[model samples]
Target: MTAGNRCRRNVLALTVPIVAVVVVVFGFALDRWVIDSGIEIAPEPAALFPSAPIMDPARQSDLDGAHFDALFAQGIAGLRAGKPGQAAAAFEAARRLGPKVPALYVNLGFARLALGQVDAAVESFETSINLRPAQANAYFGLAEAREQQGDMEAALGAMRTFVHLASEDDRFRRRALSAIWEWEAALGRRPSNGTDAAQTETNEYAQAKGSDLLTAELGRLDGGSGTLAHFRGKTLVLNVWATWCAPCRVELPSLQRLSEKLNPEQYAVVGLSTDEDPDFVREFLREVGVAYPNYLDPGRDVAFGILKIESYPQTLLIRPDGSIAQRIVGARAWDEPEMVANIESVR
Candidate 1:
């Protein structure tokens, strides 16, 4: 070959590989940017619990039979698909097949609620609670139905019962607590000293004398690390949430708006996702348009162990000294003027 041709060939070979590398790198970068920018990732079959309560097999042996089981399964499927009418029919059938099962009534109540039949829903929930007085989920359903009927006093009463009966680690505990606060506020009365006196007293917020928050480190979504100590000098509004929690999703936008309204120099809004899958957490954050810094708590070390937080969307306002100033148990309109002022008062 001629020397000029040989030189041209060598240059072409080197240039071709360099160009290919650049193209590949750019493609990957773009893909990442799209993902981070809230492009919906095909989520894993969502690890979701049915809103329709399930039959407790331990209590009702009749429900263990195939006929009742089949009807119950159909009811749950209908509820999940948003076919409340179908769900109610199925749950009613299940109840007929196993009249002793309180959960059947609870499921029926949820279906009724979905259909906006508040009175029927209330009856169903009341029946469930009467059949099994300690049924926690029934109380939750009853509380919701009462609220729908504009009975704040009854709603608060049922909610308090749910909070009292539910286990300390129940996921619904915090949301129920938040609901109690709203119901009390609406009625222009403080929570009455009753069976849930301690919870009522601390309904608005919980105080922790000392916390080990600063010692914990978590993995950030952008392939980095974060710790509570990083915002040592600023008031930290730390939120613990999960992808599957409905109340958490409802509250996230407000938290984002709150973050925007507050001065970043004086405050920091951080989210800790308790989802086991980091990919799901990232996709959820993107889908929700949450721009605040988020970290993963795959093992729930910080949420359950350090913070002793059991409910989803539990937010803590940490004072500059690393002590927890307030623990908000449920979702709220964080961007509202009053909420903003309350947060500012903490600072």
Candidate 2:
């Protein structure tokens, strides 16, 4: 072939490949935008309770929308008035009118709990969770029911899962985490490993789905000073721990080491204790020696409000932007390379 012909053929080959690539990219983008569908499962509820039995929700024809709305509103009013039985009846009537709606199941669960129908509440919450596992509130309800039945382990597990599923809101997350920690301590099975494998899974899911962490704020412990805003512009590593927690005892040293290693220009670590007794916290700190600033949260004021911290030794890696970067539900090897890498990624 002539040299000019050879050059033209080469240009054509490159152009064809580029065109094919563009077409493929465009197709994928279009599919992504068009194929997005309505979510079937509502995000897990912030509350969870154990499974139980109660009267079935009533079934009504689809045409009864107005009736359903009225019943649902009345049910909510009943719930607000601390009449779970009345609320359940209202929600059941609404459900009978609109059998497909899952929020009514959640409402029913709340009403059942108020009536002390532990098993029934669990069933309602589970139905809600199954219908919408992403709903943190359902999970929270299920956990609450389990707690009522004295099923500490399951309740604790569900509570942890709640926070893991919803840690973006400082309020709910703090409350959930504190509840989890409190229960775990109460059961004497606090996990201190701070395992990254499980945490990585949760973080990936939250990031991909844009789920919020629990962000409710508990009241201040003993009127402790400083809001979470005080830690703004700095990476805050907050650990919710208790003196009696085995895992807390195991993880304290590593946390101290990590705090010491952090450059104050970027990071800070604080340990909030739920020891119930400030003296226990003070004595433990004095004996074992925590280098980071430690505060007492015996009543879980901070744990309940800002982070919804559910369990002891729960570590939160808060970014300078004041958002949670990583949340380790149990104790962790703070000095591990992977932990440092993950924390740094958010930084």
Writing each residue's lDDT as its tens digit, candidate 2 over 1-347 gives 99999999999989988999999999898877777766657787765544766555795474475788899999999999988778989998887787656677888998999898989999998897776554567778888999999998888778767766564553566666667767866776556775433345556745743432223332244444444555667888888888668998998988888877767777788777765445556667878878677766443535654566777779888777767777789889887777666766667
Residue 166's lDDT within candidate 1 is: 61
For model 1, the run of ten residues with the poorest summed lDDT = 202-211
Clash number by candidate, in order: 0, 91
TM-score of candidate 1 to 2 decimals? 0.40
Tens digit of lDDT per residue, candidate 1, span 132-154? 67677899999999999998888
CA displacement after TM-score superposition, residue 154 of candidate 2 (Å): 1.6
User: What C-alpha lDDT does candidate 1 achieve relative to the native structure?
Assistant: 0.82
| Candidate 2 wrong stretches, greater than 4 Å | 1-60, 191-347
Q: After superposition, how far is residue 48 of candidate 1 from its true place, in Å?
A: 36
Error of 1 at 343 (Å): 0.7
